[model samples]
Structures are given as structure tokens and as C-alpha cells.
Target: MLDTAALKEFLQQQLPANLELLKSMVEINSFTTNKDGVSRLGKMTAEAFAPFGFNADFVPSLHPDYGDHLVMTRKGTGTKVIGLISHLDTVFPPEEEIKNNFQWRVAGDKIYGPGTEDIKGGTTMIHLVLTALQKFAPDVFEEITWVILLNSSEEVMSHDFGKLCIERLGADALAALVFEAGARTGNAFSLVTARKGRAVYRISVEGRAAHAGSHHERGANAIVQLSETIQKVAALTDYSKQLTFNVATVTGGTVINRVPHFATAEGELRTFEREIYNCGIEKLLALSGKGSVCSAEDGHPSEVKIEVTQESPPWPRNNGTDRLFSIFSEVSSELGLRVVREERGGISDGNFICHVMPVLDGLGPNGDNGHCSEQSADGSKEQEYIDVTSIIPKAALNTLAILRLAQSA
Candidate 1:
């Protein structure tokens, strides 16, 4: 039912062109905040898909800095609707240093560039794969409904655009394929079927201020209370349950001479289980509700509040997820590509789609150092890159996987 040989040959023939397309994508600094660059990339993407009869429209971003979401739809009479999700935004901002911003380059067997492996490669391959399928395998392409959501704000989290896009399209989706960099290879599961959810909180404390030199005893030190609270809050992280809590920022008090009246601590919570995540939240809220000893005889006061800033649910490895991975693995093995499974703590839009359908993530080309900007002092080398050799191999694998999925439907 699938033509693995023809698909491999098509991918091989299109490798050069796809690489150039990825180069252009990496060169365009579509940072989450660069509205202009993001919109420009969206236009370019729309133009690319237009030749294939995809009707593209820009969905206004809930926030201005994140640009807009690109939704492309193609008519098909298939049994189920298939969703392809990827993001165009990179973590590197536009005003950042040239070395840190978007700059495409070829070094040895790898492509050294920002967003190269993180997802530009994935997005490029999806375009190429779909394009090829539409041309060489028209029957397979016409057998299923296709919805493509190219998000522009994944790096800084959804900022509501991804949510709205999913709410709009996910209701009809039976399955989704996320084009993120796979974590590892040469293993049995090689696919990302599960990821941890993330929850962010801002814990604040308030206390009476007083002059440090004259009335230290009269002053209620909010900073000191917050400092002790940070430890108590961080202590809740349970590694056995794979729950983590980290205090990322703490701020209070302007001048050292005065006792601080207000202080705040920001932290993140991650977990692979929703129940565990909720348990941690309850503990954090309870901890934040009670303050440390200050000036009162009651010792700890009740001037604390914990607010959930944002959250993303964990995507568990379930039967449906395993089925998707199995299909992809069979196709990949047939194509002679490495296979491995990754269970990561990082969450993605795939986590959201799991609510409606089984989803697969990190199907991008094999590479490492994603979202890492670590560099030498002289800025000559980069910490991020995508293996040039794996580009078409993985893309070909995805092509076959899609064919298999369509056949099943």
C-alpha cells in the first residue's frame, strides 16, 4: 500500500532544495517577539503552500508581540482529519547579538544556525514531504483531511495563540504530528510519546516596613520571610515522582537601609503526572498562605499569596500514543533509519492535542543542542546544530509514516 522506494528516491532528489529552504527559514529571525519577521515568514510559508492548493490564513495573535498563527487547510475526502503542527518562532530575540540571533551557516556535516534543528528543519521537511506526497502519491494525500498549524509563539510558551488555534482545529483532529527535534536514537521507542507538564507560580509576601538603624525589632522583614519560604517551597520537589520546583527569581526591598515591606519569588513546577502536579500545587499554596516569623508574637503571619501563572498538562504514554509510534517506527525501520524512544520533561503543543487525539512529537531531523546558546568566549563555534545527513532520511521516514497512517484510516 506504500511505496517506500519511490518515497526515498523523492526525498533524495529534493534534499538540496529542502536544505536551501531551511537555510532561508533559519536566516529569517522569527523570534517570538519579532512580529515583522514572524509575519514575513508566515507569508513566505503561505506562498510555498499555495502552489499545492493549500488555503492559508493568518490567525491574529492574542498578544501583539507574538505575531500571528498560520492555519493552512487542504480539502480531502479521507476517513480522518490529520494535523501537522510546528512552530516558526525561535528563542533568540531579534535585538540579540548577531551570534545569538538568526544566522544560517554550513559547517562540516552539520548545519550550524539558530532554530536550525529546533524546528526549521522539521518545518522544511514537512513541507517537502507533503509536497512530494501531493505530487507522487496523490491518492494517499487525498485520502485524509489535512490541517497545518504553524505557531509563532512556542518558544516563550503559547501566550494563548496556540491554545486558541488548537481549540479551533483540534475538535476535528484524529491525530497530530509535531515536528520537534527527537531526543535520542538507536532505541526501541525512538519516538516522543510522553512529556511532562509545566506550571508556573509567583509567590509573594508582605510585611510591615521599618527603619533598620532605629527599629530593627519593630520592622517585619518581608525579604527574610520570602527567603525562608523559597527554601520551603523548593523542598517540595519530589524526584521519585519526577516533580521539580525551581525558584527562578526573587526580588524585594529597594534600599538596604529599610526593612522590605513586600517581596516576591517566582518558580516553576514540572511533573509527568497530573495528580502529582496538583498535589504539589496544593502544597505550594498552603506553604505560601503561611508566612515566616516577623515582628508579631504569632511568629509567622498570613500575608502570603500563591498564584498559578500558567500551566501545560502532561502527555502520558498511552495506547493511542504507542500506536502512532509503532506506525512511525515500522516505517522508519523499513527506511533503514535509526529508531529510539524519548521520554522528556519538556512539554510542547503536542501535550495540548493529546486532549483530543493521540499525538506524536519530536519527529524532526536528528540533532542536538536545541534551545542551547552556549558558545565560546570568542563566539566562533555554536552549541546548536542539525545533522545534515539525517535531514532526508527522517523526512522520508515521516513520509512513509504519513502514508501508513492514511492507509490505516
Candidate 2:
């Protein structure tokens, strides 16, 4: 068994350090597309890991202008490698007026900021856990091999660097733990078992324009056809299988006096099953249809086109792998925490790692309002955020115990 008292002391010491690091990181403003900020954060991360005797390296993405991905590893005696993944990017865009708004406010126990709850807090937790392991259980680190993966982009469908990180780390990992924000209720530590797959698409319609005052009957309206297609696609929702299609954006019409010549609709679909996703796409494509009317004098006819793009693969649930869960639950129980399992419609880097190894996610401080300015740490009656942080050492202890068990297995 791990030494609970020593672990607690180690966590207490590391929490303040993590807080300081997080504040610095937040000040840097590593937005998804900001190459300079991302590269800066990567260098800072490499410097931080150097003191632990780990070799840190940055793998630049295919796009030379974007921020590079980071992979930090400490090789040990075992062949079984476990990975902890987190992202440095925030969803906020650079062009937005509030781009540099990293100012944080403390309302009682709740900390409010842009990236605090979504992931910066989680990143701090990950650093704290590793630092505690390095301090209290140095021998455990020697027994097991592990890596820390920090991606530069995850907000914009992971774009390029996220996928590249998966290709680099997937083959060698025995298991992965994602450090995303925890559940709404602070008392429950959720082991995310499943995530929905996503696909983005754009549908375009073309029709002949005509004078609204005279030749209206000779023209075909593209906007009307596109509207019908949107409704047809929205009808593909299957709640039982957790498949859904949302029509996020639509644009058409130049003026009220003329029939619109073009129209475009953009949307995404999420599903838990692969076949369901395929079927939904087929249904979406079948909705494209040209209108009946056309301008004879101009020799222009109505047309419809559909384009589909695969953004990210769905992360299916692991029905058979209970070893990691058993260990996590055992450790959390030992630390006096209640463990729970959850399924979400969202996607994370864990989706890629889970394909090769057992993965658990949402293991950070509890918070809500993920993508809004009103985002605040969940400080309900339970005081879950602080409680979760207080048990950081115990979670780190659990992680070490699991790593030791995997090394032997």
C-alpha cells in the first residue's frame, strides 16, 4: 500500500507550485492558432520536465506556421508505457475582442477565467500528480515507463497536431489517462467510458436568378431547396443510439428583389456507433435536389451539391477492460472518494489513445459552463473543486500504484 500521509504532504507542497505554473501558462495566451504562444508554452513545459531527468522534445505539426506538439518521456525498466494527455490550446479565437482576457477572479472558493475550468486547471492537476510521484514515490517512477503528451490544438477539431500526436504515441502506449475537466458534481470522479464520433459537412445549392416583379415563375429558388434539405437531415436523429445532427449555420440570399442564386448550409453529426454514422451521412447526401423551375432566357438550371468531411473518429466504450477501472476505484476508495462512470457525446484526445490502450478521462477539478465567459468553478454545497484538489496526492498515489501493477503485468 502507498503511504497516504507522505502522499498528502507531497500534494500539499505541489499544489501551490501547480497554481503558480497555471497562472503563468494562462498569462501566455496559447490560443489554438497562435503559433508563438504555443511554442512558448512548449518550451516552458520542456524546461519544467528537465529537472525530473526526463528528455523533452517538441514535434512540430505538418503546418510549419502552427504551434508544435510536445512529447515528454521518462524511460524506465518496463516495456508497458502509460500516457497522460492534455492540450495547451483554448477555444477562444485571436480575432475576438476578448482575446487577451486571461484575468481571473476568485468568488469565495470558485475561480473564474477563460480556460481555468475547461483545461488549464486540469493541466495543473496533471503536473501536480507527476511532481508528487517524483517526490514521494521516486522508486515507482523507476519501475514504470510513462509519457506526457501536450498538444497545441484540440479546440478546432485537433486540426493537424492532435492527429499527429496520436500517430506518434498510440502504438507504444499500454494505457492512457486524459486530464480534462471533471464532472459537475465535485464528489463524483467520472471515468469517461465513451464519446460520440463527429463529422462536418457543407451543402450548397445553385439556382437561376430572376426579376421578382416580372419573371418570378421562370426562376428556381436555391434557398427553398436548401431549407428542405436541412429539415430532412435534422430528421435523422436517433436518440436510442445517441445519434444526432445539428444544423449549425446557413447562408443565402443577396437581396429581396431577386431569387437567390446560391445557398450553403453547414452542420455536424455525432454518434456512438460507426454504422449509425455511415447511415446518417448517406441520408444527408440523399437530401440534395434541384428545384423544378429554371430561367429559359438565361439558360441556367437549378443544381445541388453536398460535401462531407470526417473531422474526428468516435471513441467507443470499452466494455471488457475493467482492470484500470478496478485499480482507479480501489485507489479512490482508499482515499475516501466516491468513484463513478460516465458517458459523454464529446470527443477528446483519449478517443485516439483508447483505440490502442485502456483509457480513462475527466480526471480534473470539477467545473461547468465550459465555453462561455460566465465559466466558473463549481462551488456547490459539496465544495467539490477544493475537495478534489485536496485529494490530488491520493490520485497521484493511485496512478503510481496502477503504473507499478502494469509494469508487473
What TM-score number comes out for model 1?
0.93
lDDT of each: 0.79, 0.70
Q: Per-candidate TM vs. native?
A: 0.93, 0.88
TM-score between model 2 and native: 0.88
Candidate 2: list runs displaced more than 4 Å: 93-102, 170-172, 184-186, 289-301, 319-322, 374-401, 404-408
| Cα error of candidate 2 at position 99, Å | 7.9
Distance from true location, Cα of 130 in model 1, Å:
0.9
lDDT of 2 by residue, 26-144 (tens): 66667778888888878887787777767887887766656878888888775667777788777655554164343555556566565677677777777777776666667777766
lDDT of 1 by residue, 1-409 (tens): 5576776787888888888888878888887888898998888888877877789879887776678889888878755778888887888766563755436667788887888888888888788889778866788788777888888888877747557656656665667888898654453225788899888999888987878888767777888888888888889989999999999998999898897889999989998877898998889888756565577533535377788998888787787778888888787677766566687888788877676677888888878777766567786655678887776677777777887787775
Residue 104's lDDT in candidate 1: 69
Task: Provide the lowest-lDDT 10-residue window in model 1.
Answer: 182-191
